[model samples]
Target chain A: MRHYTAEQIAELPSKYRAHFINSCTGFKSANLLGSISEDGITNVAIFSSVTHLGSNPPLLGFILRPTTVDRNTYENLKKTGVFTVNHVNQNFIKEAHKTSAKYDGTVSEFDKTLLNEEYLDDFKAPYVQQSRIKLGCTFENEYFIKENDCHFIIGRIQHIYVDREIQAEDGWLNLERAQTVCIDGLDGYALPQILNRFTYAQPDQPVNSIKDLGS
Target chain B: MRHYTAEQIAELPSKYRAHFINSCTGFKSANLLGSISEDGITNVAIFSSVTHLGSNPPLLGFILRPTTVDRNTYENLKKTGVFTVNHVNQNFIKEAHKTSAKYDGTVSEFDKTLLNEEYLDDFKAPYVQQSRIKLGCTFENEYFIKENDCHFIIGRIQHIYVDREIQAEDGWLNLERAQTVCIDGLDGYALPQILNRFTYAQPDQPVNSIKDLGS
Candidate 1:
């Protein structure tokens, strides 16, 4: 097996950065936006650094690369204590990725991308109407990792919208049918195909049957 | 458009948990095991809630169900501060699911499944040798959401073992080639397929290509 030093890995091209590459395969692309300006809409960006934080309070979180240029999304969410998470599916992957670009303070990506915006009742920020799944989230807490230029933003999910047909009997989402795209590297999208299903069981059982577990 | 009250959504069957459905798709699965006895392993369970938290320090995290049945996995990780995150690919999806079975304290699911155990130099925990991607993680911190029975366990990734072929320029893992499986809901696995590539661009641009971003 070939091995490279950590220094060698770090010296690779920006496009080939390990984080960008390893990050590509697993994370779901999401759009984070909040109303901070007088117009009540100022910052929007696409983030792949998101994951489910918890389920009880229905919490979710995403990490933002700390920026010196402008803290619109972070600042807005902090000020207003509310934001929105919009999922990116096949139809909106390109438009959603566009939200990652650094636009001027006044420019809204919503105007640039083909994504439509719909505001929910009592929530100040608008969510991506075209997204197959969307969640209205209230700011929970923010923790900044000291050594990394990243800020972890936790949000309490107040409301969620899912396409009815996508729901499975056991609370499973048919993302294949949802046509949701998964990210890879810095610039690739993946379409998912279902390969199998089975129930939960212990690995060492002499007569462990996956069929016996709730498949 | 159809709408359901939060109560209606909450009353949806265990098989219909929203986050369980949405978060499980397009992600790898793993069995988290910990020993309760000096001589045997207890609390063998399966989780698809794992994610790569960070790379600089090689952090990984997974969510544990908050249910209070003396989870062996949770208890084991707590006592030892170490556990293996075993990757469940297409071949092992069924076996991996079995790891979630609520087994007696003496049962070792590792012995029950077809997975082979491999030890890392830096960690005492045994990782799944057959997994295309496996990590030996040292417990860092865990956050328990007061409102939910979900516990988020964050671990410092001490060691990562990946098949050499899957590593691309700058550590980009070609998981599509690896034939890794993504979980959707309780019993579904999705094989990922590459769909598109583009460079990063601002939303307002007439044409934004992820391929053109650095060019």
Candidate 2:
């Protein structure tokens, strides 16, 4: 099958068209984010454009790319408006994919990798303590795409934590019981699993499972 | 762990706060959009907010949800501006989650699902003949996300297809060898599995993989 056109994806090459348009929109959502710096130097990075934008004021968004250089989590969420996303699993996907490496703006990818920073509740951002599904966000709005200078941002969930046996008594969670992880283009990393949950779709039926419609 | 705050997730229960804020932002790309209706009828649905907004000029976006009702893929992309995005595999995740079953706008979730409707080459939207990564897109801009009346849209990436043995010689695309499927919140689904790829992270190095730096 393999086709392409759009002038052969604009004549390929540029890190192979950024790994073919970042694995052409499929499994992305590995997290990490974290942020800190108003001299508290904390950073943490890895983000696969975290999405889920609104669950009623619970918002979430991510995209960031164009700060062109020096984007310590967009300058620590513009000097501490807080941040923290976490997730990335299969036991710390290589220190959360080496927190996207580029390091140094006063160092501190949680002191170079095997990730571990906490702060929570008083959270001025910094929470990957092994991440069994975290959150804390806040910042709240940025937009700026204009066709590609990335940015997006948008946070807001103010603290969540999880891991209560991977949630689900209706508050959902259970990312395959928190083994989370899903990225694919900017360097793989998978681990999903939950193969079915259906129920709530109708038009004349034939798609059941939410445990056979026990819902 | 199970903390929650942000005033207990804005006091839960809007369908358990949309299944706990759409499975707390982790794995979501699953697709199947299709479109085509300025009288031609074709539709196809399911979308877990397809993300990836940029890859050079290739863009992609998704969010929709607030047309109040009759959203035949947002009135056929505002009347034929084009559409198609497909991926969502494991042999069509229950006919792509039963095209999010709402039906009626002259009912056409690709003629009641198990999807099939090509059109191709002359593309005026209508592709998912059982997708293995697809594209076609065009719309090109919408935004209107005033903090939650969702619309996003974007698009552009004229035609792509993919499946030549799940790509990767450097242009990535191995979404776990195309078994695709991810969306875990408004009806779960999951599948992923790669586990490692790394290799372009730098900060004094230590991540490796991309099948051991074969770049």
Per-candidate TM-score against the hidden true structure: 0.80, 0.34
DockQ of prediction 2: 0.33
Can you give the lDDT of residue B173 in candidate 2? 84
Best by lDDT: 2
**Per-residue lDDT of A1-215 in model 2, one digit per residue for the tens?**
87889998898888888888888888888888888878887888888878897888889887787564338889888777888888888987888887787776788888887788988668788888888888888787788878877767788888788877787777777797788888888788889888888778788689877762112
Fold similarity of candidate 2's chain A to the true chain A, as a TM-score? 0.32
Candidate 2 vs. true structure, TM-score: 0.34
Cα error, candidate 2, residue A148 (Å): 28
lDDT of 2 by residue, B97-162 (tens): 877878877878877866888887898888887788898888988877788878777888888988
Whole-model Cα lDDT of every candidate shown, in order: 0.60, 0.81
**lDDT string, candidate 1, A140-213, tens digits:** 87666443446667777677677777655556656777677666655566777777665544334433323211
